[model samples]
Target: MKNIARTLASLLALALTHAPSALAQASCSSDGTPQPVAIFERFISADCEACWSDAATPAPSATAGAAVLDWIVPGKAGDDAPLSAAATSDALARLQTLGRKPPVATDVHTAAIEATMPARLRVAHGMPFNDYLGTAIAFTPVQRAAQRTGAAPAAMDFYLLLVESVPAGTEGTKVARNMVRNMLHGTLDKRNKLSKSEQMKWMETRSMRIPEGAQAERLRMVGWVQDAQGRVIAAAQSTCR
Candidate 1:
């Protein structure tokens, strides 16, 4: 009986040793600490002759943590255009909600740059046309002390913008910039009046039908969290590989 027990134990140990190791599950959390940064959004139309000058102005490779997005309005009395009707409608709605005008350029070098900055937000990934573009974001109370005082806001607005980095337009005489191809917006729950250390996780997934002439490889995403007054509190962006 002792030998039989010993043999069974040896077999169990051998089986365990030969078994395939389980793969670690992938984490959906954002990579690093969320930092405050500005969110710069622009609306432009191809039909407007004045817009070409703004489009001609060189854009920086980076915005110093700011998420920059440009929305090109489609079908505005032009033979050559970039965005589709659906995309244009979506962009227009967002601009209207924020009470902003199109084709207006903002100086990135001034304090006005921070006017619409985001407090702290992280982006997981920004793969465009890869089945779906998705991001996982976590928001913590910026003012936990205010929460204790029962002064914290009940909720915050979040927006995920899908932008396409279009190359110089071969089909038209006009040039193209980093244009916002689509946008998604939602409200996150801050109803609990989160403690200073507590955080709320949110996920946004969007599957986009690539516009006929739009290049999928040049797509990216920008995401931002905004306060009740429409001021962006935090922003981040990811580029597609």
Candidate 2:
């Protein structure tokens, strides 16, 4: 378990900041859009202010930092759950009062949020015990183990999805670039021929030394989905990232 956490942490860090050779050898598909990786990072409260964070005045990342946490955590599930109407009211008021910046970026849509989030936050691994927007927030079991052990998780408890960035109207051949399926055009119909090959390649190169000056794009999408129970599902990108 300790090794698992260590490995997972290393993977996370590598995904964020790997050496040049570690990236070039990756079997990037012919597709072009930049894929987005689903990293098991944390999100704090400050970013989700709902003003600059939402559409109209977007931040660089429509889906980064605290927004990720809000997406994974359940919102309103229980009738007995304490409603935060006051909090909501205050938040909304702040937004209106602030007079947001001049269209920094569009607000994050609900669909984007959903897609960015996992199908469901599994609770099997001692994770937060609620569905998206549910209550009883806490870390998943494997997540806790990793935290406790102060190591990367050997067995992560979620699916890490990699996404690709495509232009608004690019379809067909170009669409395959995205790692995850978008709502409008969910997943690629054709099976990915590259993923398996890449895996095999990864196995072979796990021990190989990276050559000099071979870094690639900023990112290649890959993500980890964790359920409330702490079950981890790993889903690498088929086409994009």
Best by TM-score: 1
Tell me the TM-score of model 1: 0.59
Q: Runs in model 1 with CA error above 4 Å?
A: 1-36, 53-65, 78-87, 100-119, 126-131, 142-153, 167-176, 190-199
- State the lDDT at 120 in candidate 1: 48
TM-score of each: 0.59, 0.22
Model 1: colliding residue pairs: 43-103, 70-180, 118-233, 118-234, 119-233, 119-234
lDDT of each: 0.49, 0.25
Candidate 2 lDDT by residue in tens digits, 2-118: 445444434433332223235434333212323233332221122233421222322225554221211111123323322211112222322232343212212232212223222
Q: After superposition on all CA atoms, what RMSD does each candidate show versus the true structure?
A: 13.1, 19.0
Output candidate 1 Cα RMSD.
Answer: 13.1
Model 2 off-target regions past 4 Å? 1-156, 162-164, 172-220, 225-241
- Give the C-alpha lDDT of model 2: 0.25
